[model samples]
Every structure is written in structure tokens, then in C-alpha cells.
Target chain A: MSAATADPGNGTILRAHRVTKAFGGLVAVKEVDLEIPPTSIVSLIGPNGAGKTTFFNVIAGILDPTSGHVEFRGDRMIARPIRTWFEPVVWVTPSVVAGVISVLVYLATANADATALAVLAAIGLLIVMFLAAIVRPRWYLRLLATAGVFRSSRPNDMVKAGMGRTFQNIRLFANMTALENVQVGMHTKMRANAADALLSTPRARAEEKASQARAREFLGIVGLRGRAGELAKNLPYGDQRRLELARALASEPTLLLLDEPTAGMNPRETAQMTQLIDRLRRDLGISILLIEHDMKVVMGISDRIYVLDHGELISQGSPDAVRADPRVIEAYLGKPAS
Target chain B: MRPDIVRVLQPIVIIAVSLVVVWLLLGGTQQFMNFLTLGAIYALIALGYTMVYGIIELINFAHGDLFMFGAFVAMWILTVPLGMTGAVDNPLQLTVILVVVMLPTMIVMGLLGTFIERFAYRPLRHAPRLAPLITAIGVSFILQNVIYSVFGPSPVNVPQVFPLTRFEFLGGRVSFLSLFMVAIAVFLMVLLQLFVGRTRLGRAMRSTAQDREAAELMGVDINQTIAITFFIAAALAGAGGTIQGLYFGSVQFNLGFFVGLKAFTAAVLGGIGNTTGAALGGFVIAFIEVFATQLGYSRWSEVAVFTVLILVLVFRPSGILGQQLGERA
Candidate 1:
């Protein structure tokens, strides 16, 4: 990256430098460098087996590069802190439960089960104890995860970080409603737990209501608001794709990765998605990295394009430049096409 | 169309039908009702197995042993002079004491789970499915052996603190102790489901369970989320263990071995990862025993339970309530 062009002072939030991966004999990703500056659209174009997924895997920490570094938001997502205190409540509380178990045992055995009726009576009491779990304390003691706690927040919290994604095959939480599906995508933004849900806390109710509103807004953005309550998998193919996008944007991610966003859509849906990708950049200032096979979709929406062949960056330039490159033509067509 | 009905009525129908059949065939309504509590208790342990497997897809073979550990921890306290029984005589005091005592055992075993995952499961995370599973068996062995070392091979009495009484009502016998077991077990299962389904860690769990790599890319820390999951599930097991120990008034070195196997069957029977399914699976297993015993096959009750498991696996393969989506190894 030119110090003058892709300046760190500017808003380049993600960076990968000469990243490479090899699997013993086969080189998966070979010295690929990428800079995803803020508020811009970039497309990584390659045919199948171009190692695009592997490259994606490396930056995302799903795979460690044999050589190179990945930095997100100026910090390594995998960086480990030396030390910190967590679980303030873990030990203090457990000892108490242990003490109580002991006492309960003492009393039960002190006189107990002179008859089968006694055993039956104990069983009855057990049910009552189970019922007691419904009680959600106003202050349910929560410990920071030894590894990651705020990190431990539900998938619904995805929205708070403004982050979301779509699977190549569209893996929506199948059991959830279209509305609930988007709501789960926004799970990170919610502030409630099972206790609150079970107890029906006013705050929980309000959060649930707010989540519904947010879900509706996101669905409407992708023209699926009407299908908000439907089963996601039950939707038409194109609609499911749109709903996936809507769900992703619901998190308001600063950068969105669309994996094969146009894979199964028709020309109409593809055209619609192209416009939506552009509108997202213009309207929300949200940057996006689209993985697409359709050259039309990639050329139509990408501000800049990078072509990959066998995990190596073969070309990077304006769409017109990429289209005219001999290597790019060969990578796609397997020969220079007239 | 009827999420509520399906969610609520389905379990009720299965449970009610089983309950009625057990009552009618067990040769006594009172006897079946009494056994219902046993189902509830086993349901508690099964819930632990199911919940843990639901998120991480690990059977936690040592979980049954964790329950055994809980009983011993409580027994250690019960045998002491300042035990809960002596300290708290009233109902409310007894309640407070119970929570206090059970809390430690749960935490200790929960940590034990975290350790198991960190030391055993973590290294083998990306290995073949059998790797972590085999480690779990190793853990089970280690825990049992440890128990043998500490408590001896013979059965140690599980001391009880709560005043328990068995009484007759309208030609039916009722065990207050059994009811307590039911209450505690149910409380744990419901509480856990809520935690997993609604909480942040729970969401992370679902996401990781779905696609761990994708989840981590979404800025989810899979390791931390998994550790938390193990902790919560083990804590639940600890509760079950302590309760069972105290209820039976005896825990041997091998207490968890048979029960663990039964609970695993229950986990599979109800649905591997479904929380409600686990609880349901537990009750189903208990009732199976009741009916088998009535038919003079009490000695083969274990065989009967596994037989149902084999049939279910051979047919549905997803258990009664599990989904194929989550069936991946």
C-alpha cells in the first residue's frame, strides 16, 4: 500500500500484509496483501477453487497464515492480554451451594425413608425446587468470561457491534421466525436473559419490542418487511437471499462480507441486489466486500476490484483494467476469449 | 401456526400419556406417582448431558461422575457437626442452607468442566469426532478412580439435612423427598434452557454450534463461549449429583458409571441437544423403568432403556425431538 494512498491516518480499518498459507504440499494462499479502507466497496473476483474462501479464512482467524499478519480496527483480533481478574463471583458463591447441599443431606438422612412414602415425598419436594429456578434475580450475578465475556453476549448482540454475515448456503436459524431470525441477528443489542424472558421483565419486554422494530426496519430496507413473521427457509429463493442481506445489515456492521450474495438470484434479483449494495454505501456509509461470480454484479457495484487465482492476487485495479487484463481473462475463461 | 401449543402441549401430551400408562400398568396409581419423582431427578441429570451436548456436541461422559462428586462434597459437609441440618431447622432456613451448600459443589464441578475442556477437549477441537469423545471417557475413568481413592470402593452414605417424611394420602403414598428432587431438577432444566436460548453466551453457543469458524469471524470468541458453556452445563450436573447423592443417602465410587450411561441414553432419547428434550428424555427413562419393573423385568430395565435408544437411533436417528440440522458430529 502507498503511504500516500492507503494512509493509516485515513479510515482503513482492516489490513492484511503479504498473507500466505500452505498445506504441506499445496500452497493455499500465496503472499496476498489487501487493504479494506473505510466506506468503500471492494470485490475479490475469482473462479471456483481460486482460494478465495481460504484467504477469507486467514483474515478472519479461522486459519493462521504461514506468513503474514491480519489487523482489524488497528488491533489483532487474536491478541491475548497478559492477565486480568474475572469470575469475581465464581468461587465465593460455589462454596455456599456446597455447604447447603451438605446440610440438606444431613437432615434428609437424619430420619429419612423409613418407608417408600418418604422417598416419594422427597421426589415431590424436588419438583418444587425445580420451580424455584424460575426466579430471576434483579441482579443475576454475571462473571466476565475468563476468555471473553462481553464477547459472550448472545448472537442477538451482533447489531450492537454493527456486524453481520450471510452464509453461502444461507444458514438462517431455521427454528426462528423471519422476525425472530432478524431479531437474533440483532441479539447482541438486546439486554435480557432467560430469567428476564421467563419473568417477563418490563425492560425485557421493551427490548423485545425494540428488537421487533429494528427487525422490521431492516426487513423493509431489503423489501421483505411483509415477510417478517414468516419462516426464513420457507421464503422464495430470491427473497431468502434478500432476507439474508437484510438480516446482515440489521447489525449495522461497519464492514459487511457478502459470500456469494448473488449465487442463486435471477437477473432481476441480481440487479436489485446490485443497486442495494450501492445504496448501502451511499445511504448508510457502510463498507462492503462482495464475493460474486457474476461479472455483471461485481463490475456494476465494486468501487475497486482485486482478482485472485489460486489464492494469489493476479490483478487489482478499476473494473475496466481488470476486464482487459490477459491473466484475468485466462483465469476466468481458461484461455483468452475473443 | 401454534408455536405455543406445539411447544407446551407436545411435552405435556408425551408426559401425561406416559404418566397415565405407568400408573395403570404399574399396578398402582400411588406407585407410579411416587416414581414420577424419580423420572424428574433423572431428567435433571439428563438435562445436563443434553444441554452440554446441545451447544458443544460433547457427551461429557464425566458428567455423571460430576454428579457423584457433588454428592460427596455435600456428604462431606453433612457429616460434619455444623452441617446444614443442625444449623437450619426451619423450612426457610433449610432453604437458604440448601442453596448455600449446593452452590459450591456446582461451582467446583463447573470448573472441573472448564478444565476438562481446556486440557482435554480444546487440543482435540479440530480432530476427528472420536477424539474429544474418547477423552471424555478418560475423564470419566479418572473421576471414578479419584472417587475410589478418596472415598474408598464401598458405598458411602449421603447425609441429608432437610427433614424428609413419607406419608399416605387417600391410599397413595407420597415421598416429600422425591418431590424435592423433582423441584430441583426441573428448576435446573428450565433455568438452563432460558440461559442458553436467551443469554449472550447462549447465542454465541448456537452460532458456534452452527459454524464455529463463521461465528469467530463475526467477532465471536469461540473458545471463551465454549468454556462458558461447559461451565454452565457442569454446574447443572453438579446440582444433579449433589441432589441424587443426598436423596439416595449413598454414593459409591462407581455411582456415576451406571447412572451416567443411563443419563446418556436419556440425552439421546429426548434429543441430543434440545434442552426441553433432555428433561423430557429423563422423565421418559424413569417411567420406562417403572413399567418394566411392574412387568417383572426390573433386572432388565437397563437393557430395556438402551433397547429403546437402539430402536430410536435405528429409526429416527435424531431422537424424538432432535433436528437433523444439529446432528453433525
Candidate 2:
């Protein structure tokens, strides 16, 4: 049966068509179809162990789906059955070459014949490997991967593609100051090489100053203006949650995925967080995909709500329609005990 | 006073007290100077261990071996290619040889470090923690054996290029070599601190160390950041190795094994992920060793060092400067 889809006219920023994620014997997410429209807030609500997190993990590039696909702005972010042989070659060739050189050097040293030449040869091989890996010329990587290497896009790639996310449990850089955490979030945007960093070059310093200014601005946007100097770990629970939001925003994403952003928060904090979520979309003009447990928060802010049960979407509609659906209620309350 | 201020000053106070005690026991500034110089060497090596551990939580048993490789690289530059044997009387020539040897040696060792991480450590990054750690031990063995085979399992005498002049200070003589070594080590350490504290990549490193998954979510390339960490740490260790060879006037295949363990202890002692702590720990370890030797307990120096390590671990697992892992809300 064809899934009842969201309005495609509103400009779908993110779409997952029949996405499934399995862990050996357990199918954590099965044939889940979702659509997130631009400049809109959509919520995904499910019972405990209903595969909400697993689905989130798949779209965020943390876990690859067993089948199906995830797209952002019509560009595929994750897909099933990755091209296999190339990845192993990309990861393994250097080691194999190094091992060969090691053995050769060992033999040459033992024989004491042209030891200098052997050592030089090993160094040469190592330099070639270094250059190849660093340059990662796509054609070269692909040519070497003739054996079917499984290549998966990393989380950083997703961020560069204008997707940012927060975790279910707050995962701030505990040791870093709030300002630095946000600066790290701006990592992809900053352009400075190692040499620039070592020499403290003018260009690198200018970039650093710019990034730091932007980081502080992000912190200010999240109502954490003066807390930049505090270590993230030392922040209170509400502030820590806000810091995570600022950090995510630092990446300057077009679409933001917030996983249980209000978990463990008091009612007042939860309300504040809900308002912040709304502000993020309205002010920033970014699409939001939210996975939240607080029904009130989700119902109050989300333009659309999708309810999942046992890894499948049981109901999808506006907040009031989803709230009134019999299937959604049954999924949450076990069919009203017959 | 605020607790933060107390926390920052506590180590300094402890170190100062320890210095006073050492001075009283040794009754000379010369031994104290020697202790500081040796401490600087350990600190350089310890920074490597602490940095890798801070980011990836790997002990990097191969680090000391990398330092040993650095020593050999320095030796090869001087003895084989440059062919400067014994003492170098020409100041300009000595300075030129040092510059030539050190730059290439650090670069080679840095590349070697990057190579080790790419080949030896990167593949096993997602494996069980113990797996990469065991691989680190294996890498250590491989490096040692490689050195042993090439250098014939014996101590290769390094030429003493620095002038043997001594500076008199407060009725005590301090060797110029010791002063130069200490200056270089301090300079590198300061550069490292700045790199880790102020730079963008440095911020990425600290974030990665704190939370790898979260760092990635923020668009930090975890693999690249980790690889860079390994490179920097390995490069520093390489520099330390070169200095070590120059200081003692000898190099050995197994030199890194004992020093590696000691550096690991220093890393642990200083709070594994804390850079300043590692440097402090290195200095502390050196002081203890020198003090033990001066007190005629030279045979028990290793025992004493280990004992302090155990005491620190038992009392403060987070270390002197280390924050308790995951302690914040």
C-alpha cells in the first residue's frame, strides 16, 4: 500500500521513503516513510522502544539503514547496500603496504646488503601512502575499490550538507567551555591549515576571530550569551540543553534534528524549550524534525505529527488529527484493554 | 578564595613545596637544575601520550618507540649523512647541523606518527578498546625490533655537539646544554598549549576528546581530528627523542620501552587528558627520580616512581588537573 504522504508542494526539505534499519535478528525500524517540509516543525512521537531513536540514528548518518533511503534537499544522505570493495581498499591498502615494507626492511637489515637503500625504499613507500590517503583522489579511491568496498558517508559530511542534530541525552563537550564547544561546531566552516595554526598566521588568526564571534552569536541566540566562558559540564541542566542547541546551530544547518531536547526538564524549562524550537524555525527559517516524548510540547508547536508503533507509522496528520486517531491512541494505550 | 582559583594554584603550591624539599635534601642548585632539565624531556614525551589519550583514550604504547625512532633518525642525520663525529668546535656548523637534523627528524617522525595512526590505529578505532590498545603494544614491539635490527641491539654513541660551558648562578654551576634543552622543551610546550587552547583545530580536539559522537554531530571530522592529534603528539615525542640522544650522548633500540612506561606513568600522574598536568607530571617524576638518586637510593628510583603512581591512582583517579570523566550535568 502506498503511504499517505505529506504535501510535497510546501517544499520537502527532508524525505525518507520506506526506510528500514535492522540489527541482525531485530528490525528496529521497518518501512518508515517520513517527509519534513521546509520552514516547518514536524514531530515524531512513539512509545518506549518503538524504534524512534533507531529511525533518528539512521537519518542522522550515525547508523546506516539496512534498506531504503534518506534524502536532504533531494540529495541522498544515506542509502542501503553501500558500494563495498572500495572502502576496504581505501582503509587497508596503506597498512598492507606498510607491512610489506616492514618485512622487506627486516630482511634487508638481516642480510646487511644495501640496508640504506632498503630503508630509503620503505620511506618512499610510506610517503606515497601518505600522499594518496591525504589527497584521496576520488578516481584513485574508486579504482582501488574494484573489490566492492562498503563506503558510508560520515556524520561530518552530513553537517557539511547542511544538516545538524542534537542527541536524546545531552551530549555537550563537557571539558570545553561553551564558546569553544560552539567553535568546534563551526569546524567545517573555518578554513585554516595546520601550518597556519602552528605559525599563528594572520589568515588563521582572522578566521579564528570570526568563528569565535559567530560562536558567541549562536550562544546569544540560544539565550546563553554570558555563559560562554563556563565549561559545558558545569552548566545547569536547562543551560546545558540550551548550549547543545547553540552548538548545533553553530554548524549553520538548513535542517535541524532535535532528539528529545526537553528530556528531564521541568515544566517551565520544557515550555521554554518548546518556545525556542518554534523560534528556531520562525526566525532562522530552517526546517525542524523533532523526536519528543512530551505530547503537550509536540502538540503545541508541531505543524504536523507522525506517530509510530512497533517501527511503523500508525498515524500521520496535523496535531489535532493525530491526537484524535484511534490507531495512535491504541498504540499508546494497548487498545483500551479491549 | 574561589574554588577555581584554589584548583589552579594547588598544583603550583605543591610543586614549589616539593622543590624546597629537594633543595634541602640535595643542598645544591646543580642537582635541581638537572632535575628540571630531565623533567622537561619527560614532559615532552608525556605530552604525546596525554594528547593521544585525551582525544582517543588510547595509551599509545608505541609512542616511546616513536621517540626512539626519532633518536635514531637524529643519529642517522648526524653520523651517516652529515658525518659530524665527536664534539663540534665550530658554533655556526653545530647550529646548522642541529637545525638540519631537527627539522627533518621531526617531519619524518611526524609523518611516521600519521602513518602509524592511519595504518595501525585507524582501522581498529571502532574495534573494542582493548583491541587497539593491544595493537599499540604490538606496534611498540615492531618499532623496537626494527630499531634493534638496524642499530645492532647496542647503544649507538651520539656526538656531543653543544659546547661544554657551564654558567655560574648563585654559587652553583649549570651546564649550558641543560639550559638549552630546558629552553627548547619549554618553548615547544608553550606552542603546544597555544595550539590546543586557541586554535580552531585545537578546539575540535578538545571537543572530540570530551565526546566523539557529539563532536561529529557538530561537523568535526572525528577521523581527521584524531589523526592530527596523533601526528602532533608523535612529532613532539620525536623532538623529545632527538633532545634525549643529544643530552645523554647515546641512543638505543629499547630506549623508548622504559621511557615509554615512565611517560605513560607521567600521563596518568598528570591526569591523562590534561596537557599541563602531563607536563607537570613529567617534571614531578623527574624530580622524584633525581631526588632518589641524590639520596643514594638510585636503585630504588623506579620503585619509588611506581609507588607514587599507585598512590596518585588510588587517591585521585581523575589526576591532579583532570576533571572527573562525565562528572558535569
Clashes of 2: 9
**lDDT tens string, model 1, B14-42?**
76786667677777756575467667667
What is the per-residue lDDT of model 2 for residues B1-329, given as tens digits with 9 covering 90 to 100? 69999998997898789778877766688888878888988999999998998888888999999999999999899888988777776878877888898889888888889889977888888899999999999999999999988888879999888878788886689887788778989999999989988998888888788778777878887777887888888888888988899989999999998898888898889888889989989988998899899989999999999999999999988888767332333
Q: What TM-score does each of the candidates earn?
A: 0.79, 0.88
The alpha-carbon lDDT assigned to residue B215 of candidate 1 equals 50
Worst 10 residues of 2 chain A by lDDT: A1-10
Instruction: Mark the regions of model 2 whose C-alpha exceeds 4 Å error after superposition.
Output: A1-11, A79-126, A132-151, B1-24, B89-92, B322-329
Error of 2 at B287 (Å): 0.8
Interface DockQ per candidate: 0.07, 0.57
Error of 2 at A150 (Å): 7.0
lDDT of 1: 0.69
User: RMSD in angstroms, candidate 1?
Assistant: 10.2
lDDT of each: 0.69, 0.83
Index of the highest-DockQ prediction: 2
- Report the alpha-carbon TM-score of model 2 versus the true structure: 0.88
